[model samples]
Target chain A: MRVLIVDDDPELAELVSRSLAREGHAVATAADLESARAALVEAFDVVILDLGLPDGSGLELCRELRAAGASVPILLLTAQSAVGERVAGLNAGADDYVVKPFALAELRARVRALGRRRESAPSVTYRTGDLEIDLSARRARRLGLEVELTPREWVVLECLAGSRGRVVSRDRLLEEGWGESSEAASASLEVLVGRIRRKLGRDAIRTVRGQGYAID
Target chain B: MPSTEPGRPSSGGRSLVRRVGLVAALTAAGASLATLSVAMVVVDYRVTSDAEDDALERARALAAELDAEARAQQAVTQAQLEDELREFSHGDVTLAVWEASGRLAGDPALPSPAQDGCEASAGPDGAWMVCRASSASAGRWVLVGEPRSQLLAHREPLLLGGLVALIVVVLGGIFAGISVGRWSLRPLVRLQGALTAMDAAAPQPAPSLPRSGMVEIDDVAATIDDLLGRLRVELERSRHFAADAAHELRTPLTKLRTELELRAEEHDEGSHEGRQLLRSVARVEDLGELVDHLLVLASPESALRGASLVSVSALVEAVVEDLDADASRVRLELEDDGAVVGDATVLSAAISNGLGNALKYSKGPVRVGVQDTAEHVVLRIDDEGPGLGEEARARAFEPFYRAPEQRGTGGHGIGLALIAHVVAAHRGDAAFVDDGPGAHLVVRLPRHRGVRPEQT
Candidate 1:
């Protein structure tokens, strides 16, 4: 996976690049919006964006990318955690949002998830246990019965289902499914999982207590 | 009342020591002048009276001598009379005589008598007579006398000189008072100048006040210096707090903004990834708000006390209006004319924070209401959600407090803390109203006047 990181802070950009690199993704860094825009022309699997820039906002760039109908995954980075801000960013067409001072592993996981989502593979369907996801149709079914999930729940399920049998840390789930530093992530995730469990049955997923969750 | 204008240094502006010295000098001068005037008048009166008495006695003796001469029928020549009269005519006296027939006698230079006998005394330019008569040679008589004016005239020069000396002493005393006044007030003037200089040179050491040896001025200067020291300490503390808050906020903001820009750069417009990036940017924004609220809560100025006129109804309306978009599921109900006297900003912030919290936690719609109670303006915000337990409710307003159920709700726990601070600033109280189907938080602020509608 090819990931590009754009940030004004060289140290933070480098740190993010290194973290993503450690996750087996080729990472490139840009310290400002212009260079990052130029790097966007080059084929990249995902982009990790910092909202604040010396010359412009990351949000404007995120909107530009979405307006151009480019399907490359974008993960926005911000210092704020206000709901209105999150809503605005989401409304502006960002796939995910993350607050700064985030854990390295969390950033890596989010980048990996974005990469996986952005790849235009031939198969648009995903299967995990008895659950099946049709990406092209925007539908999920278990036991051939359609399961209704909120947009957020779908993202969470998608990230978890992509990992399939692997343990997905709570932090990674928060960063990938919602945004990093989401105060409501765990509770929201619990609610989502409770709903998912009602449809798919409880034993289909394994809770790892303090560590994470696994789906078999 | 004394004028505030500065007086001349030689006058009332003199130092205390000099003024005291001048007062002593004036007192002595006055005393000397009084003594001199009294002494001169008394001595003049005494000498005049004594000379008159002596002249009267000498006239009796001379009359006796003239009587004995007349009895012997001795012819008295002009020259002989003059020679005899000269013996009585010492300085301060002049003698003359008249016969019983009213004829002038004694040197034949005397003016004719208008009337015989003795007359009341006069002085200076006026003449007065003291007369004595003796029988000579069968009912013929000779009169001997002196003018009283002659005796008083001699002392005129001495009395005039004494009066002049007294006038001079009094004038001198007044001059001395002015000089003394100026000298006495010098130390006070010096202290005032030093204080002015100190104020002008703010943040710098003040020049020492002149030690005029006046205890009162010295004490005043010391007190002013101490007050300045306290002010400086307070200023330094305020500066320290501002610096600490700035440092705390900047690091996180810088990092978050940098990362947001970085992430925004790689995604293309209208892409699924771009939408995620925008959402991330929005979350970053929330952090800025959190920092702002935290700094405001931490500020000492924000903790200031004292109540002002605040309209609870209007404040609630304003806050609800701000939260309307976000609180689409909430309804606000305000009682007419819910007004209170309190810190308006603090109250508003508290109410808004409560509303925000209610909206954030509730699964269903939230409700807010303001009512004018008898003693307080009460505000209540209720949300249809899982209310806190006893333990969570107890520590809800504590700094950085988060319930186990709410830890993953994206709350920093500072919202309730901010509400608490706002309530405290208003000198009001806040508490959980209920724990039933929905969470209800109530705040009460005291009633006050001057709640203008236009101001709100």
Candidate 2:
């Protein structure tokens, strides 16, 4: 899969690039509107955009891409998490919106989701140890027995399963699922994980303390 | 200190009720004194005239008796006439008998008598005469008279005493009027003091004027108290609205910032589009901070609620120490132990904002000082930046006002406005002073006598 990232902050752009590149996707970057426009004309699985730019806005580019009948998923990046901005960004044809000072892993997960949606892959199944996740069925099974999970718990389980043996940081989980600060996400994540662990057994997931959590 | 502009009218100058009452009291007293003095003079004149008429009638009766004796060829001795005259003299009147030649005839002690209308026609003396006379019988005339000056002399002391009494009464009345007026108006004076404090942005408890028997003054006091209550309510309403509006704006701003970060993740390092997105996010963050400052500036009620006894020096020192990492170039000086009773949150916010503003504008270094003065607790922040012009300094405390040069700065222009509001809530004032190349902002709060010492 190929993903294009457009942002003006060098540090943030580098962080997003490394995280997405680690996910086995080919990554490309554009710092401004002109370069982003040129990249949109080429083949790409997804485009990540920042709303404010030196020349033109990311929302305007999102609208133009949609008007040009480009169906590739475009995610918007903004500093303000205002509800109006989120509505405006999505209304301009963006598939998702993200706020800054975000964790890299969350950005990677969003890109994968966008990619999967773009590819239109149906009946996708994911397996980690005894846990099995079926995208089409929207259900989870462990040891070949069906498992009941709330919508939020299912999202958390999927995130952990998607990472497999790797650790998923608390910040990434918050940014990807809750769309809020890590402080709030960290607290909420504890409750969600507790529910999931109760249903799946505690030994299935491992806590990394300050770093993150991993599932085997 | 900058001189305030002349010609701006003062709201409370002289009150009308006080002036009118004073004038009315003085006039009534003066009129009463004048009427009493005139009455005393008339009474004295009438009494003297009546006494003189009684003595004149007795003298005429005596002379008729002597004339009847002469007609019978019976001589009357001068001794007997003298004894009759002596009886009339008992009440301080002296009488004498005179012949037709204007010579003293009966009494040797009498002076040579002057000829007058009483001698001319054997009738009563003319209205101007000192004596009254009438004929008895036998072509012999009888005269009885006393000097009018003696009667007038007695009347002189009484009249003088009455005039002196009148003056003493009038003086006593004026003294009484002033004492009564002041005693009666004491509650009004207290009410005026409370109102003045309220106008200066001090929190005053509701006025409780003692009920003066005077109906009109009591009404005026009550009306003033009602007006103060209404003004306080209006101010509270405006403050609440500003706080609510700010709270409402925060939720959306937070959500927008979260979404932007999520979108930025798809781009690669060194990408042209990635950098532009990052810059956009920073701008939104600045806007959110500005909004928060505006909310604090607009809501004075929040500051008023948290009033307490706090050490001004301690608050300044703590805030400066906490901000030291961010303000390496700034220096803080504690000049005196600044202690005052005020809202802790309000005082801290005001002091910190002053320090923040100093840090933002200064090029070299900023200095903060806390001092306790005789009348006020003072907090001063001096900066090494380009100082404000005279016009900007004058209008610095107004909400949403920025100096012309500072308009381009990325602030909402409410930093000083917030400080001003907080100062006002604590019964204080904020002002600007020149500090060489920079400006010094000072806040002075009234000293609170009951301020507690620092805990540790």
Candidate 3:
């Protein structure tokens, strides 16, 4: 798998590349903004970016890439682990952010997570038993037959499916389904999850108790 | 201008109260004195002229009489003139005559006077005003005089009255000055009160100045408020920088520990090198925890995003579940479902610190409970630790203040302090109750559960 690592810190970049290479990824490293932008021209499955760079910020690069219609998954590396900074990165089109000096194992795990998501980028779909949900087309089918799922139910199903095995938090699901500024009740999210379960069969989604839900 | 530096507000010139009072008093007193002096000059001129005209009239009348007397007799004697003048002059008027040769015939005590008009002189009898006239046909000169004190007697009484007037005028000027000063400076007084009433001890100093209704003063206040806002931003940035730096440090430490664990896992669990690596990872974990607390403490209120609300009982239970290693030592009892409006990351950090602290210090089972009320909600963690000492109770919330007994122990002294900082930012309270057998740490949060429904 092709992976691009963007970081101004040569040592950190080299270390991450070496670690990911051990996991059998063809890792390419860029030390600054100009090099990273140049590297983005080549088709890469995932881009691991450091927020701070010598020439410019990674957030600026993420924004530019998204504006240029680059749909590759971008993961941000931030030295400041403040939630505000994380939200800013996300708003700028970064899929995820990890604090700097992070564990190679965790970084690899996140990159693998991104790779798993990227593998299904064109038509990301989820399946369990006879139930299959199409995320790109916002469709759901059971045993090759299209089943009508309400718009809200589809959103809940999509969010849970998108979380990939990780727990999709109640707040995140609410925000994604009801828009970011939505003050929708947590109970509403649960009800939507319950409705999705009823339509897609009972074992389709797993309730992770206080956190949120996950795909069965 | 980039107002990142510590700025002092420029004053709007002198104190309004002082300036107004001084100007009012000076204007009132000066106006009174000016009017009094102008009146004095006018009255003095009139009185002096009238007195001179009366003396001249008296002298001219006497001269006519003497002239007639001389014309009647054709040979009037000085003794006759003197006797006739003495009868006419009663209290202060005296008459004198010179029969063309300039010889005085009246009171000799009077100084040599003008022979054609009136003159005031300091005579031997007293101050005297005399008038002289001549009748050439009769070949006789006649003079009439009176004491000058009559015209000026009123001056002494007027001086006393002027003194009384001056006292009254000064008193009235002070009263006017004070009233004017108070009236104009009322806005400034309100501004001062607003400044003083500000909470200086807030975790984040908010120096918000109220509008004073005066243009210049309000402008000054606005400028000051702007500077204060910039200063707060600068301070918040620096504080967050420290937190960020510590967090950055933690990431590397966490990575190092993870690498150590992976390497150690590949080796024998009883191997010497594996044990050493495990010990090193434990040390890294401790450092990571310290950095996490610092990050929590350094975090400001601006980090709160959206209308994020989390369940108090659920969050406590989740934390307890995550710290599963101490499952046997900790007990959880949730009474009610309570919610709080806050940032999730910060709340978790604070709760983790408190729970970790109880587990570390307690030898017996730790009791965790949630008590939710309508107005407020509390999470109490009771540890079977060496409860708080007198000194610990007082300085528990102080940062980095470690007890001598627990100095070399696992827990950092900043845990409670970090919790306090978070609670203050959330507008809540963190307190320790030592009445129980162990340390009772209570975190009180404002219970705000807003359950907005999504339309069907």
Candidate 4:
């Protein structure tokens, strides 16, 4: 896999590149939007774009790439962990985002998830047994009855349902739900997963012991 | 007596209306009484003088008649003349006869004058106006006198009229003064109403006060508006500075954290060096969290960007479970799972901080309750700790303020402040209620009616 890292800080770029390189993937680094634009000519599996650049913003690059018909998955790296900033990044056609100072493992997992998005049209709904999840509408119904879920609960369930029939890592789910996969938040993820299982059913979400949970 | 306090009005001083009326009344009484007294004195003098002139004319006519009688009868005796004079006396007048030999022919008690003209004399018969007249033959003189009491008789009615005039003028002045006072104070009253209508606690800037067309009141209002504008600018500047500083710190902290974490991973798990590296990485993470808290404090309104309906009971339960503190000791009394509209992430963080504090401070079990009222959804966390004292309760929500007793607990005192910021941004209230033997933290948010529409 080929990865392009667009960041103004060389140290962060080096650390991320070194970590990804150890995972046996080819990584390219660009310090500014100009270099990033030049590097976009080549085919890449994933693009890790930083929000702030010396010359211009990475959002413009994300929009430019999408406007030019590039379907390659782009992930945003932002220091501003505010939900508004993340929404803005996603709205500009980025696939996912990680706040600054993110764990390398979480970043790699998000990269893997983005790379897996090849030639498959994203589904708006997922169904397993009597549990029906409408991702676009952010609603869930069991046996034709709507199951009430809070906003945070919905975020966790949406993440699980997005990767249907596959194991969703705990850190990734935490990052998506709580915006931080810290030790405290990881415990929150456990409690939240237990709630989702209870709302759906006992056999709704299968916990794969120390690994994570999956929806079949 | 009205109070001198600026805004509050107390009935401790005389009203301006009454003062004005009293002054007007005094002025009118003084002027009216002075003019009436002067007019009454002049009228009394005129009455007395006119009566004296009439008495003098009567005396002269009587003296001329006596002379005619004396001339008509040259052989008439003095006794016969006295008899004729005695017949002329009537009412309050006294008839006296004086001969040219300086002797009284009749009534010797009558006062004798040296020459003709009128004179006032006081004798055993009280005061009298007397006039002496000579006969045409100059052989005899006649004197006629009247009491002064009869001459000044009209003065009583004049005094009564002066008193009545004084009373009427004073009453009229009072009425005019009150009406004038009320008319002139209309603008001031309007200015007070406008000031009372201002909402000082609202997040939005207060609207400029309406013009009262009074210079002093309008000047005060303009000064208040200017002060508010300046305060708003100052507050905005500080918030922006805080946000910008936190943002600038993030990138360097990110590099340090990643480097420390990567370096810690390179060593064996149980090695002392590896443990030290992990601890350093944890410290860096703590710094990052501090930065995040500062950002939230700086701009809490921005946290509502992705607002949605959040269940208060569920949020409490989730936070309680998430706490690494002994979760088994927490007793959750979730009476209602009501919903509120806000950013779930920030709300969750605030709840987690609250529950975390309760568990950390209390020795016994912590009680967490979620109940919905008519308009608000309330969350209460009760801890059986040494409850916050009066001083602690006041300053607990200030940033970085730690109670002396809780200082050695090895945690930053930003939890409650962060909770306050989040609650205020959501237009909610967070308060500490003293419910005996524990610290009770109550957070109340406006209840969002119905569940959020299926999120789009």
Question: TM-score: which candidate is best?
Answer: 4
Candidate 2 residue-wise lDDT at A57: 92
Regions more than 4 Å wrong, model 4: A22-25, A81-83, A101-105, A116-216, B1-218, B300-307, B317-322, B325-329, B408-410, B451-456
In model 3, the runs with Cα more than 4 Å from the true position are A120-216, B1-189, B196-244, B247-270, B304-307, B452-456
Q: Per model, how many backbone clashes are there?
A: 71, 44, 0, 4
DockQ of 1: 0.04
Taken over the whole model, the C-alpha lDDT of each candidate is 0.65, 0.64, 0.70, 0.76
**What is residue B424's positional error in candidate 2, in angstroms?**
4.3
Candidate 1 per-residue lDDT, tens place, B358-441, comes to 988887888888776667767889998899888988899999989888888887888899888767666678888655787899
Best by lDDT: 4
TM-scores vs. true structure, each candidate: 0.33, 0.50, 0.56, 0.66
Candidate 1 has a TM-score of 0.33
Model 2 CA lDDT for position B38: 76
Fraction of real interface contacts that model 1 preserves: 0.03
| Candidate 1: segments with Cα more than 4 A from true spot | A1-216, B1-29, B75-92, B99-103, B106-119, B122-153, B160-164, B167-218, B233-456
DockQ of each: 0.04, 0.02, 0.11, 0.23
Compared with the true structure, what per-residue lDDT tens digits does model 2 show for residues B1-456? 222222222456653444544565567567766776676678656755665466556656656665777678776566765675676554544566656666444433334334422321221432222344545463344444444445556676777776676667656666666666566666666555444445434345556434555677678877866776777777778766866666556545544544455455456646877776666666666666566566556654434534334556656755665573555776767655465655554566678778888787877778787776778978888888888999999998887789998878766667788888778766688999865779889899886553322221
Record all residue pairs in model 4 with backbone atoms less than 3 Å apart, i.e. clashing.
B1-B12, B1-B13, B2-B12, B2-B13
Q: Which ten contiguous residues of candidate 4 chain B have the minimum total lDDT?
A: B1-10
Choose 2 or 3, whichever is better by DockQ. 3
Worst 10 residues of 3 chain B by lDDT: B1-10
